[model samples]
Target chain A: MRVGIVVFPGSNCDRDCARAVAEVSGRPAAWIWHKDRDLGGADLVIVPGGFSYGDYLRCGAIARFSPVMEEVVAFARRGGPVIGICNGFQILTEAGLLPGALMRNVGLKFICQDVHLSVGDTGSPLLGGYRPGQVVRMPVAHADGRFHADAETLSRIEGEGRVAFRYCDAEGRVGGPSNPNGSLAAIAGIVSPGGNVLGMMPHPERAAEAILGGTDGRALFVAALSRAA
Target chain B: MKARVYVTLRQGVLDPQGRAVLHALSSLGFDQVRDARIGKYVELEIADGPRDEAEKAVREMARRLLANPVIEDFRVEIPGEGEAR
Candidate 1:
C-alpha cells in the first residue's frame, strides 16, 4: 500500500513517519506538499507531527487552511483512511475531520515523554491489530494537546466507541499523573464518526521500530496497510 | 474599519495559565484581587464599511478563525459613538 505523508512548512516529523511506514509496510511513502492540493492517489494519508506554520494562531489552526487540506478533507469524506499524529491531530480537529479541540496543556508546559495508551476501541481500522483494552507505549511531545469538547459530544463518541485510545498507566489504570496533558476523559486518540479518519497526540512513528526501543506502533501501520489490500 | 476581538475561555473550563497568574498576584500581596482569567485580544483592520456591515463581518471572523467555540467564547467590539462601556 502506498502511504502519503503531508509536509507542512514547519513539519519536522514527516520523514520519520515516512521511514516508519516504509519499514513497516515495505512501501515507500510519498510526500504530499501542504500547498500541492493533491494526494497523489495514496492508499493512506498521514498528517505527521511538528509545529506546522510554527503553530501560529493555534496548533493546527493555520495548517488546516492550507491548500492540501482541502483535498485531504475531501479524501477523508470519501472514506479514505487518514491518520493524524501529534500536531497533525490538532490540525485534523481544526479541519473538522475529527471532533473536539486540542487546547494548551493544563500545566502550561510543553511535555515530551513516553506515555502509556490503552486501546479503548478496536473497531476502527487504526486500532484493528490491537485487542480491546490492550496497552501500548508511545512518545508524546506537545504544548497544546489537551483535548476538549462538550459533554454531549463526549458521551456520544463514547457510546459509539469512537475513542481509539486513552491515557493509562502501564497496568492499564486511568487517572491523574497518567493523564499527562489533562485531556478530557484521558482521551489520547479518537476516530472520526465515519471510522476512516483517526487522530491521536502520541507520536506512533517514533516507536514503530524495535531498535527504537519499541515496536508497538508498527501494529497500527500494519493494520492500515492490511485494510488497503 | 477596525475591530477588536476578545477571546476568553468559556465558563467552567479550567484556565491553568489564568490560575498561575492569579497565584503570582496573590504572592505579590495583591490579595484584594478576587479572581483573574487570562484571555486574548485580537485587533483587525478591515476595509471601511457601514457600521452594521463591519460588525457582521467581524462576528463571522471571530466564529470561523479567531475563537474556538468548543472551549472559548468571543465578542467583537467596534468602538462607536455614544456606546456605553
Candidate 2:
C-alpha cells in the first residue's frame, strides 16, 4: 500500500511519519509538498504534525490554503483514507474537511507529555486496530489543542459515533484531569461522517516505535494499510 | 484604504488568556477588575475603492481568514469612512 505524507513549510514531523508508515507497512511513503496539486496515487494520505505557517494567524490557518490541501480535500471527498495529526488536525478543521475547531488549551500552556487515550469508536480504519474502550498511550505536544464545537454539533458527533478517542486515566475512565488539554468531552480524536477522514491532536507517529517507548500507535498505520489492501 | 478588525471569542466561550490576565490583575491589587477578555486586533491595508465594496471585501476576509466563526466574532472598522462598525 502506498502512503502519502503531506509536508507544509513548517512541518517538522513528515520524516517521522514517513518512517512510521514504512516501518508498519514495509512500504516507503512518498512526500507530497504543500505546493503540489496531486497525491501521487497514494492509497492513504497523512498530514503530519508540525507548526505549519509558524502557527501564524492561527495554527494551521495559513496552511489550509496550501495547494496540496485542495487535492487532499478531493481525495477525502472520494472516501480515501486520510489521517491528520496535531497541526494537521487543525488544518483539516480549518479547511472544513472536519467539523469543529481546536482552540488554545484551557491552561494556556504548551503541553508536552504522554497521555492515555480511550478508544471510543472501532468502526473506522484508523482505529480498527483497537477495541472500543481500550486504553492506549500516545504523546501530545501542542499549545492549542482544545477541541471546540457547538453543543448541537458535539451531540451530533457523539450520537453518530464519529468520536474515535477520548482522553482517559490509566484505568480508562474519562473526564476531570485525565483530559490533558481540556478538550470538549475529553475528545482526543474524531472521524468524519464518511469514516475516511480522521483528525487527532496526539502524535501517533511518535509512539509507533518500540524504541520510542511504545508501539501501540503502529497498529493504526497497519490497520490503514490492511483496509486499503 | 485601511481597515482594522477585532476578533473576540464569542460569549460563553472560555478564554484562558483572558482568565490569566484577570488573575494577574487581581494579584496586582486591581481587585475592582471584574473580568478580562483578550482578543486579536488586525490591521489591513488594501487598495482604495468604493466604501461599500471595501467593507464587503474586508467582511469576507474576516469571515474567511481573520476569525473562526465557530468560537469567535469579528468586527471590521474603516477609519474615517463613516463608521462601518
Candidate 3:
C-alpha cells in the first residue's frame, strides 16, 4: 500500500510520519508539499503533526487555506482514508472535514509529553485494529488541543459513533491527568461521518517504534495499509 | 475604499491568551477587570471603488473565509475614501 504524507509550511513531522508508515507497512510513502495538489498515487493521506504556519493567526489557521487541502478534502469525500494528527487535526477541523474545535488547555499551557489514550471504537478504518477501551501511550504536543463543541453537537457526534478515541488512564478509565488536556468529554480523536476522515490531537507517529517508547501507534498505520490492501 | 475585518472568538469559546491577559491584569492589581476577550483586526487594502459594493465584498469575505463561524465572529468596516469623508 502506498501512503502520502501532506507537508505544510511549518510541519515538522512529515519525515517521522513517513517513517512510521514505511516501518509498519513497508510502504514507500511520498511527501507531498503544500503547493502540490496531487496525492502522488497513494491510497492513504496522512496529515502529520507540527505547528503549521507557526501556529500563527490560530493553530492551523493559515494552513487551512493552503492549496493542497482542497485536494485532500476532495479525496476524503471520495471515501479515501485520511488521518490528521495534532496540528494536522486542527487543519482538518478548520477545513470543515471534521467536527468541533480544539481550544486551549484549561490551564492555558502547551502540553508536550507521553499520555495515555483510550481507543473508543474499532469500526473506523483509522482505528479498526485496536479494541475499545484500550489504552495506548503516545506523545501529545499542542496548546490548543482541548476539544469543544456544543452539547447538542457533542451528542450528535457520540450518537453517530464519530467519537473514535478518548483520553484515559493506563487502566482505561477516562478523566483528568489521564485525559491530560481537559478535553471535552476527555476526547482525543474523532472520525468524520463517512469514517474515512479522522482528526486526532495526539502524535501517533511519535510512538511508532519500540525504541521511541512503544509500538502501539504503529498498528494504526498497519491497519490503514491493511484496509487499503 | 479600504475595508477592515475584526475577527473574534465567540462567547463560551475558551480564549487562553485572553485568560493569560486577565491573569496578568489581576496580578497588576486590576481587580475590577472581570474578563477580557481577545480579537484581531485585519486591514484590507482594497482599491477605491463604489463604497457600498466594496463593503459588501469585504463582508462576504469576513463570513466565508476570514473567520470560522463555529467559534469566531467577524465584522466588516469601510474606511473613509479619498477626501470623501
Candidate 4:
C-alpha cells in the first residue's frame, strides 16, 4: 500500500510519520509538499503533526488554505482514507473535513505528555485493529488540543458513533483528571461520517514502536495499511 | 479606508485564556471583574470606496478568512462609517 504524508512549511513530524509508515507497511511514504496539487497516487494520506504556518492566526488556519489541501479534501470527499494527527487534526477541522474546532487547553498551558485513551468506535478501517473500550497509550503535545462543538453537533456525532477515542485512565475509566486537554466529552479522536477520515490529538506516530516506549499505536497503521492492501 | 475587525469566542463557548486572565485579575484584588473573554483585533486597509461597498467587502473578508464562524463572532467597523451590522 502506498502512503502519502503531507509536509507543510513548519511541519516537524513529517519524517516521524514517514518512518512509522515504513516500519508498519515496509514501504517509504511519499512526501507531498503543501504547495503541490498532486497526491502522488497514494492509497492513503496522512497529515502529520507540527505548527503549520508557525501557528499564525490559529494553529491550522493558514495551513488549511495550502494548495495540497485542495487535493486532500477532494481525496477525502471521494472516500479515500485520511488520517490527521495533532496540528493535522486542527487543519482538518479548519478545512471543514471534520466537525468541531480545537480550542486552547483548559489550563492555558502547553502540555506534553503520554496520555491514555480508550478506543471508541472501531467502525473505521483506520481503527479496526482495536476493540471497543480498549485503552492505549500515546503522547500528546499541544497548546490548543481541546475538541469543542455545539451541543447539537456533539449529540449527532455521538449518536452516529463517529467518536474514535476518548481520554481515559489506564484502567479505561473516562473523564475527570484523566481528560488531558479538557476536550468536550473527553474526546481524543473522531472519524468522519463516512468513516474514512480520522482526526486525533495524540501522536500515534510517536508511539508506534517498542523502542519508542510503546507499541499501542502500531495497530492503527497496521490496520489501515492492511485494509488498503 | 480602514476596517477594524473584532473576533471573539461566541457566547457559551469556553475561553480558557480569558478565564486565566480573569483569575489573575481577581488575585490582584480586582474582584469587581465578573467575567473576562479574550479576542483578536485585526485592521485592514482596503481601497477607498463607497461606505456601503467597503463595509460589505470587509464583512465578506471577515467571513471568509478573518474569523472562523463556527467558534467566533466578528464585528466590523469602518472609521467614519460607523459599525457595520
| Candidate 2 accuracy as TM-score | 0.97
**Fraction of native contacts (fnat) of each candidate:** 0.67, 0.78, 0.44, 0.50
DockQ of 2: 0.82
TM-score of chain A of each: 0.98, 0.98, 0.96, 0.99
Regions of candidate 3 where Cα sits further than 4 Å from its true position: B81-85
Point out where model 2 deviates above 4 Å.
B81-85
Question: How many backbone clashes are present in model 3?
Answer: 1
Report per-prediction Cα RMSD to one decimal.
Answer: 1.7, 1.6, 1.9, 1.9
State which docking tier applies to candidate 2: high
| Candidate chain B TM-scores, in order | 0.91, 0.91, 0.87, 0.91
Q: Which ten residues in a row have the lowest lDDT in candidate 1 chain A?
A: A120-129
Worst 10 residues of 2 chain A by lDDT: A120-129
Error of 1 at A229 (Å): 3.0
Q: lDDT per model, in order?
A: 0.90, 0.91, 0.86, 0.93
Proportion of native contacts in model 1? 0.67
lDDT of 3 by residue, A139-212 (tens): 89888899988788899899888888888878888886787777889989999998999899988888999898
Best by DockQ: 2
Error of 2 at A116 (Å): 0.5
Q: Tens digit of lDDT per residue, candidate 1, span A1-229?
A: 6789999999999999988988977779999999997899988999999999998888988899899999999999999999999999999999999999998898999999999999976488778889999999999999999988889989988999999989999999975889999999999999998789999999888999988878888899889888876
- lDDT: which candidate is best? 4
lDDT of 1 by residue, B6-67 (tens): 99989978888888999999999999987889899999887877989999989998898888
List where candidate 4 sits over 4 angstroms from the true fold.
Answer: B81-85
Task: Give the per-residue lDDT of model 4 (tens digit) for A1-229.
Answer: 7899999999988999999999988889999999998999989999999999999998899999999999999999999999999999999999999999999999888999999999997588889989988999999999999999999999999999999999999999998999988999999999999999999999999999999999999999998888777
